[model samples]
Structures are given as C-alpha cells and as structure tokens.
Target: MTAVETPELDAALAAAEARCARQGATLTPLRRQVLRLVLEAGQPVGAYTLLERLKERRGPAAPPTVYRALDFLLEQGLIHRLERLNAFLPCIGPEEEPCGHGCGHDHPHQFLICTRCGATAEIADHDVAHALTAAADRLGFRPSRATVEVEGICARCA
Candidate 1:
C-alpha cells in the first residue's frame, strides 16, 4: 500500500526469481505480481485479500488460481504459511533445510506478531536457539522444527 522501497524486498524478489529459474519453473506474470504484493506488504497477507487485489489488477480471477500460485510459491520456499494467523508471508532468508521429524535441522526464525495490527516481524537470535537446544537436550528430545512466535501489541499500537 505504501510506496516505500525496502532492500530486503528487492533481495527477496531476486531470490524468488533465481529459485524459479533454477527449478525450471516460469514465474508467470500473475504469480510475479502476487509475490510482489506479498513482499511489499512486509507482513502476513490473507489469501482472500490477495485474491481481491489480483482481481482488481487482472480482472476476474478465481480463488483457485490464487491458491494454486500460492501453493507453488510455498513449495519453492519463496513464501511461508503463518499457521497461527492462517495467512502468508514472504520468506526472508535462505530456505531452511528440512528436518524430517524433530532434530532441529531446519528451523524458521522466531516471529513477533503484533496482535493489534496483525503485523509479523522476524526475530533472529542465536541465544534463543541455544536455549531451546539446551532445554530439548534436557528432555532427551531434539526438535526437527524450531519456531518461536511471540504475540503482543507493537510499540505503535501500545
């Protein structure tokens, strides 16, 4: 909605394009547009909202079309599903190496979600990972996926 340009978003779009090329998949115009919208948002975006925008820009779109594109993006790790909010956000960094069951091999960065505005911010901290590892070791369990999400009001909202 804002015209601000973010370096992070530029990098993400480049990464997505590269990934699509490497996978021999064409990032169609519609798909590219949708991805751009999500990246520009800098927060979680609902599928229905994406659909509405797509319809406005492209004229007459179906939910299936948007969902299909989203599925493709997610599969390629270009986007991530925010399960708690039932929304989607563009992935910020390298694709996490998948950890099958619970071994902490591939983990998503922690998210600080703003309850008031529904904005999601990524939190990267080695200490938090270390603490989780230590706790898991004590329980004789290794986490395959490590995601930490904290929800509260953001400064502006507060």
Candidate 2:
C-alpha cells in the first residue's frame, strides 16, 4: 500500500522545503524520508515505528539517525510530540503558514485525542492558553512551553 497519497504528500513536502529555506535550515533527504513516514502514518507514531519503516525501505537504519531526524523535524515545527502517547504527529497548521498564535514553536496547540479510535484533532484556543498562563503567573510559575492534551472521544467516536 502507498504510504501517502500523491498530491497531498507532494504539497506537504514542498511547503516543508519552503519553510526550511525561510528559516535557513535544510531539510535533508533523510529528514524528508522521516517526515513522510510521520505524515503517512495518519496517527501518532513512535520513533521505533519510524525506524522500522526506514529499515524496511533502506537496508538498516541506526536509532540515533532516526532520533536526529525527529529532532530536526521537531525543531522546525514540522511535527509535534505527544508526551502522553510517546509518539509524534505532523503539525496540523497550514502548509505554508504558522497558526498565527505566536506560540513560537509548533503553534501553541492542544490535542483532542479520541480514547476509542485514537484519532486526534489539533486545536489552538488562545483563551485556554491565556487562562493557563494567568493561572501559572498567579502561582509565580513561568512556563517556557505548554501543551494541553485533553483525552476524550471525538465527535465520530462519541
């Protein structure tokens, strides 16, 4: 089976290339391969799964190689890591633009993970972020980064 359908994959790759150029970073071939695997996964995927897929296509891949690529992708804001799931998901922002929330990296986003189907929806709610920030400030805590993951059945599953 094809890992990803053609048109969407092509667009995503192109957009990634452009984003990298704008940020003065290079998305090398290896990194592109890793990104493709993540996008085609259609759900959060673990690092080992990515490595396994890479090994299937290439002869053998080192764990560090896969981890390095994942690091680069995360740094470029091209993907998100779901800490709870210990997996990665492609960022759901517009192909060529940031979410405009000024979240700095990966677009201050949250996930609605369906407990039953394991499907996830990415949402950026400024109010929620603001409220969290306000609460943190009240406690004299400074948050360098924030990720809010709400676990429940999505509309389809519900």
**Top candidate (TM-score):** 2
What tens digits encode model 1's per-residue C-alpha lDDT throughout 1-158? 12215575566566677767777887888788888877676678889999998888899999999999998887666667777888877663423221111212144467788888876776557689989989999999988767677899888789
- Per-model TM-score, in order, reads 0.72, 0.90
Instruction: Pick the lDDT winner.
Output: 2
lDDT of 1: 0.71
- At residue 76, candidate 1 shows an lDDT of 66
Error of 2 at 103 (Å): 7.5
Point out where model 1 deviates above 4 Å. 1-11, 93-107, 130-144
lDDT of each: 0.71, 0.80
| Prediction 2 global C-alpha lDDT | 0.80
lDDT of 2 by residue, 1-158 (tens): 12345677777777777777889999999999998898899888999999999999877889999999999988888888899899988762334443334232644688888889888877888788999999999999999989999999878777
Task: In angstroms, give how far residue 127 of model 1 lies from its true place.
Answer: 4.0
